[model samples]
Target: MRGSIRFGEFLIFLGALFLFWQYAPWDIFSALDRADLIIAGGIGLLICFLLALVSRWFALDELIHIVALVIGAGLISLSHDVIHTANWSWGDFSFIDCSGGPFSQERDDTYTHALSANAANPNIQVQVLNGRVDVETANRPDYEVRIHTCVRGWDFDHLKEVLDQTYPKPELREDGFSFIQAKPSRGFGMSANVEIILPQSASYKVSIDSSNGRLLLENLSATDLNLSTMNGSITLTHVAAQSVKLHSTNGSLKGQLSAASLAATTTNGGVHLELTPTASGRYDVRTTNGGIELDLATQAIGYAVAADNTNGRIRVNLPQFTTQGQSRNHLSGQTANFAAASIQVSLTVHTTNGSIEIRPQ
Candidate 1:
């Protein structure tokens, strides 16, 4: 009986290690380097040790089990919090007072700011800890940015206070505008949705960095554009740029882009790209664990295409190119006019665990 119990404990220990390696955020090391989290961890460990010692002395197995249950519950809560706020700190250890799920409280607020677009084309940069971001052209030829904050939890006052303190106002600079969150709130769930309305007649540059949220860009013309997120989907429609780059860690990306050069990459989601015939530039898309769908204009002047998948099939629907190195997992081809190509577009798509589909629009 004792040997069986020991074996069960060993299996549990191995399972815990596997879960930590798979889901625990690697960025927690950065937090540990800080004094705050280190101090919090030290205090927590001391308390847990003392409680265990007391339970053992009193032979209170039930008490020990109760304490273990509480710790498990706390860890579950912390994991959910980490999904939204990737940064782990002492604040996250605070007990969340919400009765229901993480996002249960309800609160909403709107903020608006205007920018004076002179003769020079303006630039905009936004960073958010959580929530969706939408950028679109304004109906009028004016520059404005709007933010809608939504909070759902048991604590309303705490959420409001955090929102007001973290994001006071937009800081306007000479070349562009920026909105950054300084710190995260304790014991609450919230999200902020941002909308940037640019002048229809003017072209600008935009960059967005988000920790967790969907991003939507529509009907915007920019000289250079960059979009990145840790845990959210991305959608682009009617976007025109000279150079565009997009990245997501754990979400899908779908876009119809008109750009001189474009690159899109994701770790665990699919990618879909739709290009125009006149879109002549270098295009690259890659994902680790999801499929890829590429739609190219049938009347494209010239083309160079390559696609690969490690554990899935590959399909190409373009007739102009003669396929070589064709297999269930790899494809390489070029346009029929490869020798006399005039306006050429280079395309590359790769995925590790899913199919790759290329078709003409």
Candidate 2:
């Protein structure tokens, strides 16, 4: 009996560890949200304690078990209506709406609105939690934005209702036009894909923030542009801006930019930049664990180039730029005969665990 109990405890401990490792809320804790961290920790502790009790490794009084049961029941009751459907994946567990229940269907809805650019240089801002965003400049007479929303669940009607209540409409503000997701639903599996069409004749300042969505911008002429996402890729083509900033936590960045000043960074994704730099400007590109491929449109005229990688090769294809610290991991030099230039360009690219490739377009 003693041996059997020990074996059972070992199995229980292994199971508990597996579950914990599988479902650990690393992103939440890393975000440093105190309330969410506390709640997650409490729930984890409770699960462990209950598993210990089941394995007979910890002796708990009957009153303690009763109180725990009461608390658990209360939590379940509170979350009953909120647990309709969720698109959550952890390790080998993926929750999908295929149970054919009342809440297992998928629904899609679209909303669109037109805005008139009141100012000479209007400002546009967009915020989305999930899905894709595509922005393009068109030769249209009017500016328009469209939202395509997809919600999946067993309770399709409820999800649709929640989306109708939570999704924000396009509002014309004093400074510009805003099309943002102001409120999010409690526990619905939903994604909103946005498409914005801007007038080609007008220059605008645009800012977009997405938590988990791919962003694509094409043929845009903006005074200032800022795009960022936590876990989604960004692609830009034929974009001209005075100042541009792009960032992603775990996604790639690809841009063909004609910007005066540009900066791009990613934690776990590659960066590909094809830049037509200004006379005097800075282009900074960095990634923690991904490669960088850069193509400069003009010759290395009055340009100071620096590229570095911790655990990968560094290749520079500019002939006039003599490498000073040429090694397997680092390269830095200035273009020859660039000392007397009135304006200069500085390009810096770095990656911790990937390659750096720089060449002329």
Give the winner by lDDT. Answer: 2
Taking the tens digit of each residue's C-alpha lDDT, what string does model 1 give over 1-361?
7566557655654565445433444333322233344455456656766778766454364345344444444454445445434422231121112121234433444444454656465778888766667888866744666766545444545655655655535676545578774434433445566777776777778889875667888898888889998667788898888888999987788878877787889987899888763446788889989999988775635678888889988888886778866777778888797556555788888999999989887
For candidate 2, which ten residues in a row score worst on lDDT? 92-101
In model 1, the runs with Cα more than 4 Å from the true position are 1-71, 82-119, 150-160, 173-175, 185-190, 277-280
Report backbone clashes per prediction.
Answer: 2, 6
TM-score of each: 0.72, 0.71
Q: How far is candidate 1 from the true structure (C-alpha RMSD, Å)?
A: 9.5
**Model 1 Cα shift for residue 298 (angstroms):** 3.9
Q: Show where candidate 2 strays beyond 4 Å.
A: 1-118, 153-157, 173-175, 340-343
Candidate-wise lDDT, in order:
0.67, 0.68
